[model samples]
Target: MNLISFITKHSQLPVKGVENTVALLNEDCTVPFISRYRKERTGNLDEVQIAAIVNFKAQFEALEKRKSAILKAITEQDALSAELKSKIEAAGDLTTLEDLYLPYKKKRKTKAETAIKNGLQPLAKIIFGQRNDEIDYEASKYLNDAVPNEDDALEGARHIISEWINERSDIRNLIRRQLERFAMITTKVVSTKKEEEKAQKFRDYFDWSESLSRCPSHRLLAILRAENEGFIRVKIEIDDDKALNNIENRLIKANNATTPHLQLAIQDAYKRLLYPSLSKEILRSAKEKADESAIQVFSKNLKQLLLGSPLGEKRILAIDPGFRTGCKLVCLSAQGELQHNETIYPHPPQNDSKGAIKKISSLADAYKIEAIAIGNGTASRETEQLIKRIQFKNPIEVFVVSEAGASIYSASKIAREEFPNYDVTVRGAVSIGRRLADPLAELVKIDAKSIGVGQYQHDVDQNQLKNSLDTVVESCVNTVGVNINTASIPLLSYVSGIGPKLAENIVAYRNENGAFGSRTEIKKVARLGNKAFEQGAAFLRIKNAKNPLDDSAVHPESYPIVQKMVKDQGLALSEIIGNKEVLKKIDLNKYCTESVGLPTLEDIIKELEKPGLDVREKAKVFTFNQNIRTINDLSAGQLLPGIVNNITNFGCFVDIGIKESGLIHISNLSDSFVKDVNEHVSLHQQIIVKVLEVDIPRKRIQLALHK
Candidate 1:
């Protein structure tokens, strides 16, 4: 097969485009680098398109490997023929490949092998041909040594015929299709664990049955989890009569002398071999599909969370709110460096309310805290209220940041290296503050999964999840662009081709030699060679650079073109930067070249229009309904404002100032039919929702968007 052309056809991209993309990918060109810098070569394919090509290329390579193994296995058996070779080569998917190799695959001794050992092969072949009239006499003739009677000889022949029917690829394929379309997924509570408290959480799924095709991703994940926990039994099955009828129609050639034997073989094959095997295969494939869907949703949510609004570089006072242990507070510099730390007990127990207020006010004044970030943990609401009651010398923007992964980050190796002198609480407070100042920068320091916003993340394919989440982080970082001078090692690591080691090198180089003055200077970082620099430079923003475009997203390779444009227009490069009027005057077509087409040229023009622009909107304060403090405080028909904290396939969880977030089901997302919950709300989206149902015993709250 012409793999390049096949990939091009499957991806629906131009042949030349896919060819060039594949070439670049083989050359180790990163997706962000190719999409941003090599637009002309890829026909202006975005990151998503380039990644799809990468995935397809990997898939094709895997298929080729599997085909080679099958060919080798069959040839070793001395059974490889031109027709068999052609079939194996033409096999499209794994299912087909496995089906074709099934007859060749080695297995333990079965009834069929035993029957063949006892000289029932001739009788089996005669029965399959259906041309024999004296089948009983023929069976009696073979019943000499091992075969004692006609019944034994006939049963052995039936076993051999069953194995033959099971090996036919066409029959397997037909039955697989039927299973995919008509399989029913049913679950039942384990008899012994039915009344367990943990099992009650999965009560809805305990005695439920649904068509596998109609099962939603979230619901399927839930059922699988219940089954995995041993609280419920799960089974996938289809109507046997229908399945058998279809299989027989495809296998049985005619209704003749051997018709009864063939019918018996077909029934035995389906019941004993086919159904069990195909059912598992169908369920496994369905689960993988569901996993992909859930992972996509998770990747989207992680991207949004990582790219949440940045408050820019501001001196932030962060508090990891607590009651008995006190609110661990730390003041962070604009660059996210820890300057001071303290503990204030403002809630309950040590209600050193006066001292806490005075201490907070003094710290805000001394540190010149621009924004106050309180980690939304145990005593977040109380801490926010405490800070609000006190007056600072300057206007301080108070933000209750989601401390989803703060604790994890606090105890992490990255956090330890950054704050060796401080403890976990101080590190956590710093994370909260840094998250408020620049979410993308601080959040990258923690594991993507630990940051939350995924359904059954642990249950999905782990390696696939990591790769996907990493892609999302890379995309978000490149799209927003990172300040090289201020970015953490983790944030820098996500910038295009910069891996963990390169990020550390960049940080070390900065530490040794102040800050980067130009994008060109990045090459000085240890091991950040031409290729890595070429892939990474455009995404890393160097503020106060000698060249204005260096601070912008325009690649350094395109600097000569920008200079030419400025020279032709009789203007300095600075005059063109951020001057939309001057940028509009220059014709982008004039700058387009063979290597740099209209796509890159237009992008350069856009960058010149708003040089060094931060694409993220400014962070705004979100307030939860003050009347409600916890889930127990919630009531039916109470309308309250909340922030969308986590979104899943079923619905989004809204944080209405409590530990238990209310879930707004898909049906309640709008008065109309909402097919996708994401279409109605997004992560960190602030909106008002009316309380629909609050089950105090189960600690579940159902919410609906106000009509």
Candidate 2:
């Protein structure tokens, strides 16, 4: 199929770029590594483009595998022919190939097989050809003990003809086209479950009908979930008469005795076989497209959440707030190590506000806490207000972090391994603190789905979702460049070319010996071969390494080029690193060679300008309006500050310092058409929103973007 050309055409990328990227992928180069380091070979393809190539390459391989299996199965059936083989080989898609092989597939007992057993093939063929005028006489000749009458014999012949019509690729394709273009998806509520409290969430889709092609991805996923949960019945419908007439025009040639038989056969095929098979196929194709769209949205959101602004390496005092159980508090070091843990009941039944304030102030002073991270969960607003009243020795920046998956992380196996003596509350508080300090390093320990940034995540394809989320984590991890010495097993596992096993080995070696002194020292770990090092060394940074470039993004193979540039300029490595004036004066063309082009040289210069500099912005403190605390307190047309916590194709959900989050529909996002919700707002972005509507009974709040 000329796989390279096929991939190039589909991906719409340069042919050479696609080919070279495929070659590198074959050599086990990761997307992050190829996009960052192999710019010359891949024609400067970004991570998204390289990922597309990888996906298309996997698709091509899967198609080829399916074709081979089909060929082998047909050959074993002794039904392979030169023309059929050529047709199957030329088929580009799985649907076309399966259609061509339908007639050769084995099936269980059917009426057609029974009719063929009764010697009715000749009569069926005669009737199908439409050349026989004496179809009754021909049918009578085939009557036997099993088929005692012409009526029975004719019915058998009709069954055989129906089977023949159903298996024709041309007829299936015709029905497929009709369904793809004209099908409507309709849903009906199950009478018994309609009044259930749980089913009220899907009440909007109870009696809905829409064009399947025009239905949005989120809506389709919702309807499908409803159907799966037995709250509704879904159906795909098209015009039956139109489909039958189209098949008749192609199959029936004349108006004779066989004409009526052909008409019946066509009707049976359209009703019993063609419509059912092709309708499901079209719906499945639509579902897959919807799944892809949802996954893309999810992956984008995950990237933003993982790379959210970090309060870099600050000693944090984090609180997981609660009302009756008290707030679980933990103090973390600059490196996110748990130092002390306790509980404070500043709010209600045990209103020991004075004691809580005294304890918090003393702890902040004793641990040198620079920031306070309060989890945005139960009693979060009250806790934030209480913390503001406390008088600390230093001016501490208070940040309210999203605690979506903190509980999940606290109860996980990873948490258990890290803290065997601590309870889930303490671990949860620690996670909240670490997330504020370095989100990427701490969030990788939790599943992306549990982070709650996506919509209908559990409804999508699980395997595809996992692969996509993993890719995003890997890309973000490599892009920011991991601190190899302090990184946990989860963080290091996402580094380029390092899997779970190798990450464990590295950690064990470090615990047994000491921290990695340089990039070269990574090779001393058990079974970390050259290939792994080649792909991983550039992304793993050693702080204060003897060789300065080890902590930068420059690959080891290109270390000589950086050295030559430094030597040519007659400056010490220390003076040249982070010296933008000295770097800007150096001529990049002087270092360009066959392997190293202008792109690589320019990248090297930029890295030296800011060695190991974090690409993410610094975290800033945010405050929600104090007047609004719940749905009842909100009013229409009131402007309130909020944070964008979750985004979807429809719109984004904002936390307005309340128990229920308000939603801003896409239509209200701007004055113009909103093509993408992300273009208007991003995850964790702070903005002001006007309350549009508040339904206290349903616990729903609709909002409009005010800024």
Best by lDDT: 2
Per-model C-alpha lDDT, please? 0.89, 0.92
lDDT of 1 at 210: 92
Error of 2 at 236 (Å): 0.5
Query: All candidates' TM-scores?
Result: 0.98, 0.99
**Residue pairs in collision within model 1:** none
lDDT of 2 by residue, 1-707 (tens): 77897798789999999999999999999999999889999999999999999988888888788888989999999999999999988887788899888887888988999999999989899999998998888888998999999988888989999999999998888888888888999999999999999999999999999999899999999999999999999999999999999999998888999999889888887888788888888889989989999998999899999999999999999999998999999999999999999999988899888989999999999999999999999999999999999888789999999898999999999999999999999999999999999999999999998998888899889999999999999999999999989999999999999989999999999999899999999999999999999999999999999999999999999999988988999989899999999999999998888878998899999999999999999999999999887788988999999999999999999999998899999999999999999999999999999999999899999999996
Pairs that collide in candidate 2 are none
In candidate 1, how many Å is residue 617 off? 0.7
List, residue by residue over 67-167, the lDDT tens digit for candidate 1: 99999999999999999999999877788899899988999999999999999999999998887877888789888678899989989999999998899
State, as a TM-score between 0 and 1, how close model 1 is to the true structure. 0.98
Query: Candidate 2, TM-score vs. the true structure?
Result: 0.99
